[model samples]
Target: MQRVRVLVIDDSALVRKLLSTMLACDPAIEVVGVAADPLIAREKIKQLEPDVLTLDVEMPRMDGLTFLENLMRLRPMPVVMVSSLTQQGAEVTLRALELGAVDFFTKPSNDLASTFAAGAQEICAKVKLAALTRPRVRTIVRKLEVAPRLSADAVLPRAQTPDSRGGSRIIAIGASTGGTEAIRVVLEAMPPDAPPILITQHIPAAFSGPFAARMDNCSAMRVCEARDGQPIQHGHAYIAPGSQHLLAMWDGARYVCRLHDGPPVNRHKPSVDVLFRSVAATVGAPAIGALLTGMGDDGARGLAEMREGGAMTLVQDEASSVVWGMPGAAWKLGAASEMLPLDHIAARLLELARQPIARAMRAVT
Candidate 1:
């Protein structure tokens, strides 16, 4: 197998060296070159022609976002961002994902060397996955302009009715690679009355808050990072906090969000398996499970469990996935009752959300 060639770009020589050294530890990865800023990166890109790039969010002469935008337009390739563990860094990292970065890693707030050492495996793994990703060519950054907030009832007219209420209906979604934009597309297209959504996307703790905030700003549905004991509500979506696994549990009458600090499942802290299995056990047939674009099989068995538990299951078709590993695994297990394209998922979910529990179950399979 050909080793993946990577270019390291950071204003800090220490960061550049650290990144280069960390990536080189993997025999399958080669540090082809290093650049201090976007200007140098641009030139190195031409000369080295690397397979993947590790970029810094804040760099002298040219910021990472602008450089990524230009790179995607002129010479599209895989990129993984190295971001600071700050609010500002989180915002920029999300923007980089929107602009075409395959993924990002957050630098710890204290003890940089120790943190980097601990996260080296993750860094190398992401680089390998990014190398396999197909880069999309978007000439301009996708605008995430804020939209007017709509009440839950605005989309789901019967949402407030006692009979049409909470515990009986639920939606669980999971995604990883290229998930930031994929999730936004789904949420933006959903109706106001859509059932409460539970999401577990692979991301660091520092970025989850900003990711939720960005989702809230652009989506009609109220989006926020999940807190332990928060009740699930209609017209809102709860994203699993970074470093925690989010599970849905029934408290006699209604379902509520629960956070767990269990060891990483499938090598992901907020593993999709944990969330899906919890929903299968709690919500049963009334639940709808959708596995979007991701790079591993974390959610496959859990999604299959959801299906066996009588839930309607959907998997994003390979044609639309950034990396079809997770969804493909589920589909192979006969976990998904429906295989749909990305654009159709939101509308299908809304249609299912409006149906009576019995009818929703009958409509699938």
Candidate 2:
């Protein structure tokens, strides 16, 4: 098998060296070259024709976003952004993803050497996954080896029985990898009066707030990071905070968001499984669950739980996903009641939301 060739582009020599060394440590990857800025990168890209790129968020001659925009417009290829763990970095990295970058990772604020070493596995895994994805296109369906990880049960116990309380229907969504953009697509199309949406997207603590803010700007529904004990209401979308697990709980009369500071489940702090299981237990048949694009199987079991609890479950079709790991796993497990393209998910959710609770419950039965 051919090794993935990667070009390291960063303004800092230390970053370039560290990124190249970490990536090279993986036998499946080869560091083709390094560039100090986008200008140098442009030349090297034409010369080396590497399979993937690790670009720094801020560069000297040209910024990463600008370079990414130009590259996608002309010659598109898989690019993973390397950014700082800061507010500014989060905003820039999100822009990079919008410009067709495959994924991103935050650089440590301090202890560069040790931090980089510690994240070597994650860094390599992202690059390798990016290589399998088409630039500015949907992700190729594939699976990667996940490290030993805890299940949603580690954070919250499985509900003994599905909760069938009388309340407004809610929507639950989970995504990773290429999810940020894919999520933007869904939110933009939703109506202002859409059902309450609970989302769990794999992100860093610094990025989730900015991500929610960005989505709020584009979505008619009010979008915000989920708060502990916050009431879930119509026309609002609650995003799971990057540092905590967000769950739905029946608060006597209405559903409310509950944030848990528990161990990471399925290697994610805001595990989709944790959120889905909670919805299955609390919202039951009236709840609608959709598993979007992601790299791993975190949400598969949770979505199945939702289906078993008589909730309508959907999975994004592989053709529209950047990585089909999560949704594909759900479909294979027979968790999804329907598989739809990215464009159709919002409409289906709204249509399902309009159904009488009894009818919606009957469809799953």
Candidate 3:
């Protein structure tokens, strides 16, 4: 079997050595070369033609982001960013994802050896995952003119009525590898009065806050990170905090979001399975579950439960997925009510939202 060749780029000698050592420990990974800066890394890329590149965010000569932008435009290849955990680091790392980075690893601040020791398996796994994903060309994002944010309660149709104690409608979404872009594509197409959305996109704690902010800037809906015990309001999309499981619970009057600090389910904190199951158990038939481009089966079983409970389930087709692992698994289990390409998902969701509660209830029965 051919090993995945990797090029390590970091300004810190210690970081380069530590990363090289961690990657080398995995027999399937081969350290082709290491560069102290992007200038040196640029030449190494031409020479070695590594399968993956581990890049640092802040680097000498040229910053990683600028280099990455050029690389994606000139020669698109899978690149995993090794970023610091500071506020600035988080912001830039999110931009790297926007610029077509396959994934990222947060640099440990203290006790580097011990931290990397704990995360060695994760690092190698991400590298392997990156190797399998197709590299996308970085495109120039046209800036949208700033507009006033609208409240959902003001414009969206109310799910509640005096005649019935009907539950609120929600859309639950989950993704992992290549999820940032996937989530962005779905959210960007959402109308102003779209259903309340809850998302669990596998990410580290430091990056989640910035990611929510970025999503808010790109989408029409009010996007924010989920907080413990927060009310699940209409016209707002909530992203699960990176290190916690987001659960939907009823508080007598309305459905609210709750964060759980339990052991990782399916080896993922804020696991897609955790979120999907909560929506299935609490929201039931009023929910819509979407399993998009990702690398694992974290959401397949939970999505099946959602389908059994009469909720609509959609999976992105393999042709449009970066890895096709999660949605493919869900499709194989007969969990998906509809399987569509990424471009059509948002429109399908809006169409589902148009169905009257009476009709949706009938379908559930």
Winner by lDDT: 2
| Candidate 1 TM-score over all chains jointly | 0.88
Model 1 residue 89 lDDT score: 89
Q: Answer with 2 or 3, whichever has the higher lDDT.
A: 2
**How does model 2 fare in lDDT?**
0.89
Residue-level lDDT of model 3, residues 1-365, one tens digit each, is 89999999999999989999999999999999999999999999999999999999888889999999999999999999998898899999888987899998988889998998898998999999899988876433332333445557678867755331245689999999888888888888876567899999998888889999999998889999999888887779999999999988887767889999999999999899999999999888878999998987999999999989888899999887878999999999999989998878888887787677566677778
Q: What is the C-alpha RMSD of each candidate to the true structure, in Å?
A: 4.0, 9.4, 3.5
lDDT of each: 0.87, 0.89, 0.88
For model 2, residues 238-314, the per-residue Cα lDDT tens digits are: 99999999999987766889999999999999999999999999888899999998888989999999989888889
Clashing residue pairs found in predicted model 1 = 155-192, 155-193, 156-193
Ranking the candidates on lDDT from highest down gives 2, 3, 1
- Candidates in order, TM-scores: namely 0.88, 0.90, 0.90
Candidate 3's C-alpha runs over 4 A off are 138-167
lDDT of model 2 at residue 341? 87
- Error of model 1, residue 339, in angstroms: 2.0
